[model samples]
Target: MSPTILAAILSVGVSAIATEVDSPQTQASIAVPANPDNETFAPLTPIAQIPDNSGDSSDKILEQINHYSNEPNALDQVTNVSQLRDVSPGDWAYEALRSLVERYGCIAGYPDGTYRGNRAMTRYEFAAGLNACLQQIERLIAGTNGVDGGDLETLQRLIQEFEAELATLGARVDNLEGRVAFLEDNQFSTTTKLSGEVIFGLAGVAAGEDVNGDDIDNVTIFGHRTRLELNTSFTGEDVLRTRLQAEGLGSLTEQTITPEGDLFFAGATDSDVVVDALLYDFPLGENTRVVLDANAGASDDFASTVNPFLDGDGGSGALSRFGTRHSIYYYLDGAGIGINHAFGDKLELSAGYLASEAADPGDDTGIFNGPYGALAQILFKPSDRLNIGLTYIHAYNRDTDTGSQLSNFRSFTEDAIGNAVPTSSNSYGVELSWQLSDRFALGGWVGYTQTTTLSTLGGQIDRGDLDIWNWAVSLAFPDLGKEGNVAGILVGMEPKVTDSSVNIPGIDTEDEDTSLHIEAFYQYQLTDNIAITPGIIWLTAPDHDNDNEDIVIGAIRTTFSF
Candidate 1:
């Protein structure tokens, strides 16, 4: 029993002992986010974490390992033989078990609630128990207090009987120890992990026409967006992230006179990889977090958009840019800093400022003078499934980030109200998300921005304000067809100039009508690391003008993550 059980336990258990002794930790399973900011349904967790090397390995492994058998599976440690219900005074090995329990304080390796002396124990199981007893006895010999002579004699006899088995176990453990040390010495980074996502899309303008009656091109294009993230946690609680991205997906909005059909993942890097995002987030106290973005930071990085299921981040959520989050969030981007403070479980506040030219050193082009957005928001959560956010943004010289060029600035308002003239806007938005049930959710947002032309072209025009409005409603079905599937429908109005005081072509403004945007997408998680989404977007008007023909954009996207 001892020879077989002890060998099996020690052999397989040595690797565990080596791991424990070296204290090389495996990371806790915190699903690595496809977009690290998001913790919910992030993606396949494959990155290995190097744990904090601390604590005693031998003590931990020794307590659980058995000799040659693996079957003495127990969780609780028994200090007294009586704690093991199967053992009685009439048992033949009762005195030996009592001696190990009370004298040397060994035998804590017993499985939970049993002492099955009648059963045949495997080598793995014996080695596990033997490992614990050996460690306890070793300590006794090293201490000056000395062990009891009678118990020592009994231990000596047992040692003599298992001397050959013990020698083999020692050699195996030593070899494992060397292997563990080698791994510890060669690991790449103890503080950093790499996770990435790659996306391939086949997209095209399926239908449309310009206001001038020109037919839209129906050419299909294949493109890709790839991102690799370097996530570093300096203090375990704080994270420093750097994202490198290469995106070639063209905006389908380019197919029409309006930008309403632009894909959320669409971007032009000219196919060259660039540093897409860099930020460091650390906790200030128990409920406050501070983030410093050196480049390409968006408002969603800090403020609560309140639309969890649709904050696309390019790959995980919706398909169109307008479908991702409130248009107000698009105003806050570039380099910036932000802070989030929670008042309690039900309420929170966030504030941040970003500058498009924060790095420019020239006069009138630096952080304070360049295009920038300052934002403040209040988030309310009445329950685990509902979130509401009220947001306000103040900006100078920045256009609406996800709208038509006409909506970006009052069209024909002399230099487009953006290029030659400085523009100032105050935007307000309200966003709400409610998970109605495990399978269904509702979310939406309404945003309004009032902009005043700064230049007025040297008194040629009045510095009147323009009113722009946009809103959308979404219905989300989670696990629609499969466990990891999601189907979503979005219906909304694109940003349109409802009332413009800025003069354009002999009138205050001719901006009229509303452009309706309807979109639907179903993301099917093909595997832990892959998702395929097919979606379509319909635009009712080319730039809030019914004179233009309606347009449709179609796409099939595939995403891979690790």
Candidate 2:
């Protein structure tokens, strides 16, 4: 009976944690004029020619005016120009005249069929005309500024004046200059980005037995478990990353129970960390690539509270050789380098090796001597819709880590009876995936593993090996309202069955265990920069006698760009 179980039950009345959300403010309106006093507002119609009209010039002018007026708005009459009647004498017509000239070009008229000198433009009219002028200038600068004799100086001066007015109006267009640069280079360019995800979750056991194989007696809530990562990039082609994770046994209530029956809350410490990356981009052809990577850390596909890879970092699970609970997840941890490459549109290949360390004699480190084993894999994808893969691994168990140590966290340990046992093992597996459409996809993997153990004290033990498999499918909506925003759901599951044997000197037992896991996630985009995601996980482990195994996890996050 672990003491931490009781502590979790006591904290049931505690409040759930809260998350923060950021909302964007709507922009306020600004007032400016499209036509300034200094500009002339005129239609393409030529001066009503007196009898002195020259060479079809009148016809050409009329054609131009009719072409420009063909659209909804036309400058046939001066009233189409913006009005700024509040101009006081000697005031900075710098902004006023700029507005007028922008509206009519040179000369402007009035709505009464004449230019009204004293008619004051209301706030609404002023804002509309000003916005129109700004939009036109922006388009001209974007389209003509790079052409020969495109009046670059005029465009610059106009941009500066508009910017000044915008600033004075308290409408700060933050990073507008950067935006201009980005738009200017919209043709062919590359950008590198660094991003990461943080996950915090809680897990509870409804009914479960202990390591002693006792009848079901306790329900425990475990963890303050969290995962963190740091990512880096060089050019769009290179990437480097690091990750750290931790989980503890204690909380606001109590930690663990004592052999003599004491209550306590034993807080947590460092769980595991990893540092790794590709040395350089491996190019196979124009479009194919292959890369190499090396790293060390601990992780799990779904949950890590029960058995963390670096469990050696603390507590009773700390680095041990024999006695410790052995789970498939824990055995899968180790560092190795791998090769991944895609050729043309048809073939792809990948494979890697992992070396496991030895634990102290008191735990099941699966290590008999030095480094444990190695793994290799290959994958083929003929198209985006289909994929097939295979993997092979050879593992070595040592009797002791006394003579050699290959790497950190992966060495050999002795058994309880001082036996330096060792094991030689091999495993084979296959993988597959299918993207039925842009909105949905499915995937799965399966494998069979076997092991042979030999020891100076226990002779030889042959384990019957086991089989494992995982499957998943997902769907998403396209127009979810932009990036960071997604609508739809994802569902996945894994079913496991293991039939194997262990030969210990005094005890030999056949073990058969099975478990099933189901999970789902839904995401909602609140705005361009904010999103909310909610998910749930359910597990049924007959071997552990757990029921109603449900866990909830979700997050509210906001992102910003510079």
The prediction achieving the highest lDDT against the true structure is 1
lDDT tens readout by residue for model 2, 124-201: 222223334445445544875322232334334323433433232223223445676786687232433344333222
- How many steric clashes between backbone atoms does each model show? 36, 39
Once fitted onto the true fold, the runs of candidate 2 whose alpha carbons sit more than 4 angstroms away are 1-196, 210-230, 233-236, 244-294, 297-334, 356-369, 397-421, 460-502, 505-508, 512-514, 518-541, 544-562
Which whole-number lDDT from 0 to 100 does residue 228 have in model 2?
A: 46
Q: What is the lDDT of residue 475 in candidate 2?
A: 42
lDDT, candidates in the order shown = 0.71, 0.33
Candidate 1 lDDT (Cα, whole model)?
Answer: 0.71
Q: Which candidate ranks first by TM-score, i.e. highest?
A: 1
TM-score of each: 0.72, 0.44
- Candidate 1 displacement at residue 299 in angstroms: 0.6
Q: Tens-digit lDDT track for model 1 on 398-472?
A: 776566555677343434443356688999999999999999999999999998888767666676778888999
